[model samples]
Target: MSKVILITGTSTGFGKLMAITLANAGHNVIAGMRGVTAKNAEAAKELGALPNIEVAELDITSDNSVNEAISKTLTKYGKIDVLVNNAAVSGFGLLEAYSLDQIRNMFEVNFYGVLRTYNAVLPSMRANKNGLIINITSGASGHTLPFMIPYLASKFGVESITEGLQDELSQFGIENVSIQPGVYPTEMNNGSKSGIHADKPAIIDEYGDTATQQFNALGSALFSKMAEFKMDPQTIADGVLALVNMPKGERPLRYPLDAVAQGTDQEFIDARATIKAKWLAKYSN
Candidate 1:
């Protein structure tokens, strides 16, 4: 059962680890990222050198790039058995402090990027009557938080997509799941990777030291929890593998993988599910 898989944002973090993990398990993996021959050439070369992994030039932000990469994969492999929508950008700022354009830019990568990949891959998946899509969302996707509003909002959008599409595509045997990963010490959170942060210096200044202090405190607490829980990015990669290897109809709609949540994430997920089921029942009746 060596299924063909395509994963976006393979240049780093969970996506990169998933590529290696899945490929090592004998799955055919297309590691998709932007600037394959330019900015990401080294990563592309390194991953391409690995067995069962092929690095493809795929910029999720562009429809053309997404379509081309998916088309090539389908043309070569005939069908993509699974797609991991792991590509996303993170941002942090007060909601009012962020410019509309900055928010849109973050959405371009985090929200629209998922849509691009879905539109590109769904047809072939539907035609084949079988497929799985795993979206890497956030632990806060069910709710909201200060500072990381835009970033979490975008992830929440994906969570919505995953839930709705699960039923919509069920008839065709297609499955969708969202992985809500809490803070892990990946490059994305560790300062090595640049994030779309608040750029309105004037607005930030207006908010003054209070906002800055709160933001700093939140960051410190999150980092501390990450260390205390030993939250490894590999856990996400392993979770993806587990989902992929699961029986076709046995996967849950939402999989929360944050050890730091100490079961509270699961509690939230279950509570939400209960409420949603009740809502659906009322509508059906």
Candidate 2:
């Protein structure tokens, strides 16, 4: 079946790959990005040259952008059968070290961005009484990665939101799904290392050179580990296609993309269970 799909963050990463692949697969793709400058226009032209791909400007942080993109998509496609919330930003640093503005900006993009997009499409979906909402989260949603506290927090919020939406929207015949992809060779992981500033200012008068060296070492290790497990963006796109194609009853609410992510998620769940059990035993009524 050739369904109409709307996707965000199509300027790059999984969004771009999925838009191209889905269009190639004979679906109508409304690819949304922040701005349609000359560069983006060229990219959209290239994509539109394909079977059924179109690009629209959509900044998830802005209500006008989100509304315009939704209106344009509806005007072109009639109705959206699938909505993928893939627009998000990465933030790094110790939790205690980040400023309120920095934290708010992170949530604005990662958390509230998805909410805005979801709200923009819900009215139509509800009226139709059928639709799919796919949220692209991260493996970090289940496991904590050092120095990526803010990013993890945002994704955790996404996980919670998706879970609740799945149950709440089911009554309306809408399906909500979340995909947690492990480290992938995207601009996201490439930009992660440089994007987050250190939480604390350097105390050169006290712990000078050693402290700086340790911080540098930690970042290098993080990047190296990410490279070791990085999967291709196409792998994620394939997983998304599979999840979307599954029958309603058979579809999983959350899909972990790769083996490594599955194992890491299990470990995190087990650790949480153990801690909760211990706490209950220690303070039981």
Clashing pairs in 2: none
- Residues 1-285 of candidate 1 have per-residue lDDT tens digits of 999999999999999999999999999999999899999999999999999999999999999999999999999999999999999888888998899999999999999999999999999999999999999999999999899999998999999999999989999999999999999988899888889888888999999999999999999999999999999999999999999999999999999999999999999999999999999999999
**Candidate 1 residue 223 C-alpha distance from true site, Å:** 0.2
Error of 1 at 217 (Å): 0.7
Q: Please report, in order, the local distance difference test score of every candidate based on alpha carbons.
A: 0.95, 0.79
CA deviation > 4 Å runs, candidate 2: 192-222, 266-285
Write out the backbone clash pairs for model 1: none
lDDT over C-alpha atoms for residue 208 of model 1: 94
lDDT of 2: 0.79
Residue-level lDDT tens digits of model 2 in 1-285: 989999898888899899988888888888888657765676676666777888888889998899889988887777889999998877655566677787888889889999998898999989999899899998768656666778888898998899789878987889888888777767776773235444454433255666557657877865676567655689878877887788876776677775545476756655765896799899996
* Alpha-carbon lDDT of model 1: 0.95
